[model samples]
Target chain A: MKNIYSTLPVIGILLLTLVSSALPANKPPEKGGVLPVINLPIPKNPTEKVYLGLSGDGFFKIPQIKAKVVIIEIYSMYCPYCQKDAPGVNELYTFIEKNPDLKNKIKLIGIGAGNTPFEVEVYKKTYQVPFPLFPDKDFTIHKACAEVRTPYFIVVKINDDGTHQIVHAQLGDYPGADPFLELVLKASGLK
Target chain B: MQKIRLANLIMVAGMLSVFVTVSMAFAISDAYKGNIYQVGTIKPVDSKLVVKKGNQAPDFSLPSVSGDKVTLSQFRGKKNVALSFVPAAWTPICSDQWPGYNIIKDTFDQNDTILLGITVDNIPTLFAWINQMGKLWFPVLSDFWPHGAVAKKYGVLRSNGVSERALFVIDKKGAIRYIDVHDINKRPPLEDLVGALEKLGK
Candidate 1:
């Protein structure tokens, strides 16, 4: 009994530390909120336009994503963490794309916060990102999203009314694909 | 027995806290997000522009984060050099600017040019802060010991100890080809720098 009591406090502290490190201390006020409907110009790339199911050239909003859940990666070509996180994000997209059950249900998109179309194209060409990425040259979307830090992840649940309910928001990058997918599944309640 | 248990618990708590604090400080991706001190807005340009397009770039040797003295004149006749001077280490715009250069290493390589990143902070400070960007392709030099001597030569040293967010493109002949004394408040568009580098060949 005495030994167990001593071990319990140690375990508790370990748990506390793990929990604190997992979530960024300065996470933006993104969770439990409705992501504003920001419009993006239709992509010029035919494949990208088809991938996002975009039609008619003017603009499109996040609610138009035909999926049960959408994972919006708010990133910047200039952000170091975003550059670091690129490969892992591409891996996540592959995992979802290859998996039949979750393929169409979960969609991945990246927003280049404060990035011009030229900058976005450079990032796409550099990272070989498979998904559609939109540019926010004037930071219109970034300001709408509370100017969140780069490499920020927002998991939004698509409701019947087409509103995006942000279920989870994480600052910094997530390590590894499997564990991060588990997190996305859990956050979006897909599992 | 109870007193010993209390002591043990206290000891464990202390160790855990230290471990956690150290972990946060040194973690690869988390370090940058943890220490971002926001400065809303400041002076656009606090120093005069002295180096003109055709002038010879003032040369200097400064210690880099990589533990070597980088001399501008060393690259003369060998490679074109783009001297990137940021205000200070760990500040808002300065922190992310160099990291942005990481993705565009090809542009510099293709242009047969090398970038030398200079900041007013000392090596120790620059090391910890630059680590936030992972390993940069270029050398990051410290202009700290002589207090922005290199920056002062280029007329980029601010009224304060910090350097101006400026970039100098010196051709193979050591003739300064381009000079951008950008607004201190924002990142100078990467296109602007790349455009300058592309212009060197012409």
Candidate 2:
């Protein structure tokens, strides 16, 4: 079994190379091969001390702002989805604020990237964001969180029975938050 | 000989069918035409700003990257507004997206439209980046105050505090005549924008 496991991948690669060579020189296989772009190794999970930068207001951190559930909003100023989502985001803020217990358990943070500091400052002023929005100028936070782009979110929670397990991680465009929020609520044991 | 010829024909036909299927899958036909959607139904937003077709455009007093106040009414006189909502600057998508506006700078001018890219990013940041990227033609507006307020009005702000990649073609009358929302992964084809611009005429 061990020998088979070791040989399988190599055998598969050989088969792939053979099949590719058999095809007409002008026409390569339609799928399956190494991509052209430079690939970099990324860690699946972030280590401690690798924190998201300060929100534009200079407040909040990854671990410092402790909560049962942490809702991190990753966005850029000009994205239409981000713009369209602004009101929804405001509502999310309002919803959490209205629920003290949920608010205590759930912490909302916004991280703005890909824009200039001045741009971020303007965004901060215009939105009147109740929560802090961290600026990921260097993309260190983005890499640590494994975010591909803005208008997505990362929801994390400490499990109910303790042990502080990193229960859920979700990322998608705006409308994807409902499911993420549900997972967070479950992780926090909020029915 | 006949048997070999028959086999070859079948193999070629099979390959052709597979090629056609894949091409159709990747084709950029009106993939979004029948799939159009209102921004509201997709997410939650503030009720104050409703940007829709034929609706009198909401007015906003915001600053440009140059630190000048930009008002909706300013473009009401003659120039139509091509408000391209970008996700963020400096990222791969935004880098490609903003430069797209620059490449088509003359298109907006040819159509007598004022193209403005608006975002929550601030002026100094925008100024420096624009200088570096050299997109002097498309003024990136800052909806930084009241934060995402303009985007909220348009129902395009994502839940994450950034605006989605939404394009709005506002006519001289200040009505949102055309709205195209592309999948975040793709940019709306230039042909679509040009086609919409043609409709802006009589």
Global lDDT scores for all candidate models: 0.80, 0.56
TM-score of each: 0.83, 0.42
RMSD of each: 14.1, 18.6
How many clashing pairs in candidate 1? Answer: 0
Highest-scoring model, TM-score: 1
DockQ of each candidate relative to the true complex: 0.11, 0.01
Q: Candidate 1 chain B, which ten residues in sequence have the lowest lDDT sum?
A: B22-31
Which candidate has the highest DockQ of all?
A: 1
Find the 10 residues in a row with the least total lDDT in model 2 chain A.
A28-37
lDDT of 2 by residue, B82-176 (tens): 88887655434544356435545566777889888887767776675565444366677987678888888787776777777788888999888
Tell me the tens digit of each residue's lDDT in model 1 across A1-191.
77876676676667566544432334254779877757878777787777666676888777787788888888888788788788989999999999999988888899887677778888999999999998877665665565666777888888878777888888875776788899989988889
Q: Per-model TM-score of chain A alone? A: 0.81, 0.57
TM-score of candidate 2 to 2 decimals:
0.42
**Candidate 1 chain A: 10-residue stretch with minimal lDDT:** A20-29
Q: Kindly report which residue stretches of model 2 are placed more than 4 angstroms away from their true locations once superposed.
A: A1-191, B1-49
